[model samples]
Target: MSPVRMYTTQVCPYCLRAKALLKQRGVAAIEEIRVDQDPKQRDAMIALTGRRTVPQIFIGETHVGGCDDLVALDQRGGLAPLLAG
Candidate 1:
């Protein structure tokens, strides 16, 4: 599976959902950057993804976006193939 990275907050339900979906899709490890804990990281996340939201996700350098985006990708049968790379 491709490495998963997520910009997340501690109490964000979307972050939790995104993580759960990645886990269910056979992602064993996730590099979680806690943007909420570090104010600088939130700025970094915005700079990197152009989004100021928790649960900004990446799968192997490909930006998978947020929780709803992830779910839509999975439903479209794109998630597994992306992770496989």
Candidate 2:
């Protein structure tokens, strides 16, 4: 499986939902970067994803975006293939 990484905060519902979905999809591990504890990381997340959202997710090198985007990708049959890589 591709490496899964997510920029998240402590109290983000979207982040939790995203994690649950990824776990259901058989993602065993997730590298979670907490932006709430570190201001620099939040800035880095914005620079990387061009958004100030809580859950900026990355499946390997490809940015999978936030919770809604991830759900859309799965609904469209793209998440499985991407995760396989």
Candidate 3:
């Protein structure tokens, strides 16, 4: 499986939901960057994704966008192949 990373806040429901979906998809670990606590990480996340939003997700080198984007990818039958990469 490719590496999974998520930029999240402590109390983000979308972040939690995103994690649940990832878990269901057999993701054993997620490198969570808590941007709520660290301003630097938040800046990095924005710079990398071009969006300042909680739950910015990266499946390996692919920027998977936010929670809804992930669900859409799964619905389109693309997430599994991306994860497998």
Candidate 4:
């Protein structure tokens, strides 16, 4: 599986959902960056993604955007292939 990373906050349900999906897809480890606790990281996230939201996810070096985007990719049968890489 590709390396999974996520920028998340403490109380985001979407973040939890996104993580659960990744786990279900057999992602054994996730490099979770807690942006809520660190302003510098949050700023970096915003700069990289151009979005000020929790649950900014990435698989390998590909930015996967947010929870809804993740779900949509799975629905379109793209998630597994991305994970496989």
Candidate 5:
């Protein structure tokens, strides 16, 4: 599977849901960047994604976006293939 990375906070429901979904999709390890613990990381996340939100996800180098976007990708049958890479 492609490497999974996520920008997340400690108590965000969307982050939790996103993690759960990724785990269900066979993602064994996630490089979780906790924005809640560092202001610089939060700024970096905003700059990288152009959005201030938890659960900003990436599959490999591809920005897969947030929870809803991830779900939509999975629903569209794109998630599996992307993860396989």
Candidate 6:
């Protein structure tokens, strides 16, 4: 599987949920970027994803959006393949 990367904040429940779901799907390691720790990282996230969301997920190079988007991808059988790549 490719690397899993996420832009997250300390108190975001959605970030926790997204991490859990990814873990459940066998993602052993996640390169978590804590935007809460650094104000500029949040700006980088928005610049990269065009969204001001807590959990901006990326499976390899694919921008998977937030928690709901991750769940939807799994439901539609796209998550695994994306991860596999």
For candidate 2, write residues 1-85 as lDDT tens digits.
9999999998999999999999999999999999999999999999999999879999999999999999999999999999999
Candidate 5, residue 53: Cα displacement in angstroms equals 0.7
Worst 10 residues of 1 by lDDT: 1-10
| lDDT, candidate 4, 1-85, per-residue tens | 7999999998999999999999999999999999979999999999999999989999999999999999999999999999999
**lDDT (tens digit, per residue) of candidate 3 on 18-70:** 99999999999999999999999999998998999899999999999999999
Which of the two, 1 or 2, has more TM-score?
2
Model 6 bad stretches (over 4 Å): none
TM-score of each: 0.97, 0.98, 0.98, 0.98, 0.98, 0.97
What lDDT tens digits, residue by residue, belong to model 5 across residues 33-67?
99989999999999999999889999999999999
C-alpha RMSD values across all candidates: 0.6, 0.4, 0.5, 0.5, 0.5, 0.6
lDDT, residue 39, model 1 = 97
- Which of candidates 3 and 5 is the stronger one according to lDDT? 3
User: What's the lDDT for residue 50 in model 1?
Assistant: 95
Worst 10 residues of 5 by lDDT: 45-54
Tens digits of per-residue lDDT for model 1, 1-85? 7889999999999999999998999999999999878999999999999999889999999998999999999999999999999
Model 6, 26-72: lDDT tens digits are: 99999999998998999999999999988999999999999999999
After TM-score superposition, the amount by which residue 28's alpha carbon in candidate 5 deviates from its true location, in angstroms, is 0.4
What RMSD does model 2 have? 0.4
**How does each model score on lDDT?**
0.94, 0.97, 0.97, 0.96, 0.95, 0.95
Q: What is the Cα-based TM-score of model 6?
A: 0.97
What TM-score does model 5 achieve against the real structure? 0.98
TM-score of 4: 0.98
Find the 10 residues in a row with the least total lDDT in model 2: 45-54
Give lDDT for model 4: 0.96
Which residue pairs show collisions in model 1?
none
